[model samples]
Target: MTTRTAEMLMAVVMGLFSVFLMWKSAELEIGWIPDEGPGGGAWPFWLSAIMLLCCVVTLFRWWRRATPESRSTVQFMDKNTRRINYITVGSLVALLVLTHIIGIYFSIFLFLLFYIRFVGRHSWLLTGILSVASPVFLFFFFEAMLKILLPKGYSEPLFYPLYQIIY
Candidate 1:
């Protein structure tokens, strides 16, 4: 497909998703309650609202624009670009799926290493640093500051003690 086609399609999909999020968030009540912070749906509601606005603006521009040059001209999806795009996106999706079985932080480390070293052809040193640092940063950020729980998956049993110490 042409680049315009892709962008248009993405706009449509994003708009639809934004609508869905707004609908769902509205059901949960986005407003904050007395003495309580924003409701469960506040973030999704506002974020989706912004997304919807942006999508409308994007679509309007696409609709009004004339030539390909007016937009961010997309170079033809050459073989290399296609391959790299596929590999990177595929790795991300695979990581998401695998996280249910393995864990989030672990999968991130593995995926980053694979994508950088194998797909993007970066150095081993870079891969090693990223693989280790990404998860460590996530552990501190999510667990320590946010106090949010992440899936440990199968690593739960093996890594629970580690989490107790870190978190």
Candidate 2:
């Protein structure tokens, strides 16, 4: 379909999704509690509200043909773009599957390695640095600092030594 059609469709779909999120979040308190800061649903509810507003603005602009994208009749995806989109989606699916089996850290490492080394055609040094550093940073940020344990799957035992150090 044309870019204009695609833009309008995405706006509508996202607007609906935002409304759904707002509804779900509103089931919990969206305002501040006396002892606690923001309520559990505050962030999600406000963010969804903003997203809905943005979607409304986008729809209005599209109706007026106020943006170049709204005016364009160009095809949304050429063959090369379609191929790239498929690859990205496939890679994401693989990441999720691998996360269930191998764990988030290793799966993310593999994902970053493939995307940086192959898809991005970056230098090996840069690729290696990023692939290693990203997972390490995530581990420290989530496990150490935030005290939130991400799924380790089959790789759970491997992190025992590090966990000992942290705890």
When superposed on Cα atoms, how far off is each prediction in RMSD? Answer: 7.0, 6.4
Write one digit per residue (lDDT tens) for candidate 2, span 1-167.
89999999999999999999999999999999998789999999999999999999999999999989999999999889998899899999999999999999999999999999989999999999999999999999999999999998999999999999999
Q: Candidate 1 clashing pairs?
A: none
Evaluated at residue 54, the lDDT of candidate 1 is 94
Q: What's the lDDT for residue 60 in model 2?
A: 100
Candidate 2 clashing pairs? none
Clash counts for all predictions: 0, 0
Which 10 consecutive positions of candidate 1 have the poorest summed lDDT? 67-76
Candidate 1 regions exceeding 4 Å error are 2-76
Candidate 2's error at 4, in angstroms? 7.8
Candidate 2: residue 114 Cα off by (Å): 0.5
